[model samples]
Every structure is written in C-alpha cells, then in structure tokens.
Target: MSTENAAVNFSELVNRNKQTLARLKESPRLLLHRRDGEDLVLTTAARAEQDQTVVSAATRMLASLARREPGGMELLLGILPDVFPWVRFLPEPDLHAFTVELVDTMRAADSLGNSASVAQLLITWQHTAEVHSDPELLAALTRDHAEDYGPATNPRDVA
Candidate 1:
C-alpha cells in the first residue's frame, strides 16, 4: 500500500484494537505506528512470543490491516525469548517462509514511513542471522534449549 494508505489503515486498526494496541504501546521493546498509507504494521525491537496472546492479537490486527489496504502487510518477527520456542520448532522450509514474510512485511512498513518498525526488523534479522553464524552462541543456544526442553533435536527447538 502507499504510505498514505498505510498510515490511515494503521490508525484505524489501532483504534479498532485499542486494548491490544495500548498494551503494545506500553511495551518498551515494541515499536507500533502508522505510516502514510492505509498500511498498519508492528515492529519489535526484540523478539517476542509467537504464541503469546498479545503477539497473536497483533498478527490478527495486521491481517486486518492487510485486508483493508489490499497492498500487503508489515510485521517484524523478532527472535526474542518468548518467540524463540515456537520459531525454533518450525521446519527449515517453514522457518525460511517465515523469514520471507517478515522481510516483506518490514519492507512494506518501511515504504509506509515506519522507521522504528524498519529498524527493529533490521536489528532482528541481523541478530538471528548472526546467531546462526556464531558457532559459540549457536552452541550455547542449543545447550540452553536442551536444558529447557530436555534435549534439543533441532536448532529451532524451544523449551
């Protein structure tokens, strides 16, 4: 969607989901805003729970925004503690798909003038990609996952 549409849609969505939006606004780690278009997007400064009610709510809100704008959706999926568990369990193909979706959403958000969201997505993508590149951190994450989940069968495994 155009930046103008994104902004309008974002404002409308926030207004519609006032409660959840309010909670998100309260989060120090989240960047929620509307660009110029009818697009509404949420960008996270860090990873959040994929399965958390709030995250799910945000996702739903994004979906609604997409429907309203018909241009697409913008979302930044972070690799924070809450979301790691679910993302880790995703199959490789699924994980890649998720990444694609995230990148696309971020791009759309950026087009709409949501700098905070864009920055958050960039940070998250960098962190996740870097974490995989670093053997030490990867090993530590694996160990932690194993400790929490009773044996890490996959790098994506979460407790």
Candidate 2:
C-alpha cells in the first residue's frame, strides 16, 4: 500500500469516528461492535440525556410542597446546591428570581416533574445581569447587606 492510500484510509477512519461521536451526542444511541474469528468492529455509545427520574421526583416533591406552602420556591433555593452544585456560584438574588420565575412557570403549566426545564430556567436567568441593590429588599430576601463590615452601633466612638 502507498503512503497516499494509507493517509486516505486514516482520514476516513477519523471522519467515521467523528460521525459516531456526533450521533452519540444526541439522546442515547449505541453502535454494535462485532468480532468473529479475526474480524473486528469498533463501536461507540454515550448517554447524552442524563437520568431525570430522580430530578423529576424531587421536582414533584417541590411542586407538592409549593402547593401547600407559599414559600416553597424559597425553600428550594435554600437547598438547590445539594443537587446542582454549580448554581452555588451564582448570586443569591439572581437565584431567588430564577426560583420564583420557575415556580411560577411550573404552577402556570401542568408541569410538576420538569426539573430539566427548571434547570434550563436557571441557565437562562444566569445570563442576565445582577440587580440586587435595595437594602430593604435584600433584607426582605433574608440576606444581609453585601458590604456591611462596620460595627452595629456607631463606630466613631471606637478608638
């Protein structure tokens, strides 16, 4: 075999692998690898969609509780990091707003087990700018001032 022919064959194999990876990225798909005697075949598989059963169950629980308690959205945010660790990096106020909007959407629609949508909602919310400025509003949100390092009383009297 000539070097040119070998290079062409290598490029073809690379293209085939790329196609397989692309296919595996959509939902869930698997290729069959077969081997008989000396014959061999390569296959690829990936779980593109994460298992949402547990997430849905949690969302259902939140929805049921929200139906009972008006502050269910707040409660969910209070513990959102337990499930979505990256969300902890987002500002608390943005998260609060995101949770409120998601709760509203979930309530408005007949969606009780759509945590994926809720997560997508958070992703959308994160793209926006932060606007937590009002002290009263921040306090009402159960969060302290962002830059309050002075003494509670007048610090002028301190040496």
Model 1 Cα lDDT, one tens digit per residue, 61-81: 664554555444323233422
Number of clashing residue pairs, candidate 2: 0
Ten contiguous residues with the weakest lDDT in model 2: 1-10
TM-score between candidate 1 and the true structure:
0.29
Q: What lDDT does model 1 reach?
A: 0.51
Error of 1 at 21 (Å): 39
Worst 10 residues of 1 by lDDT: 1-10
For each candidate, what is the lDDT? 0.51, 0.53
Relative to the true structure, candidate 2 reaches a TM of 0.35
Candidate 2 clash pair list: none
Q: Quick one: best lDDT, which candidate?
A: 2
Q: After superposition, how far is residue 58 of candidate 1 from its true place, in Å?
A: 25
Candidate 2 Cα deviation (angstroms), residue 28:
10
- Residue 151 of model 1 has an lDDT of 46
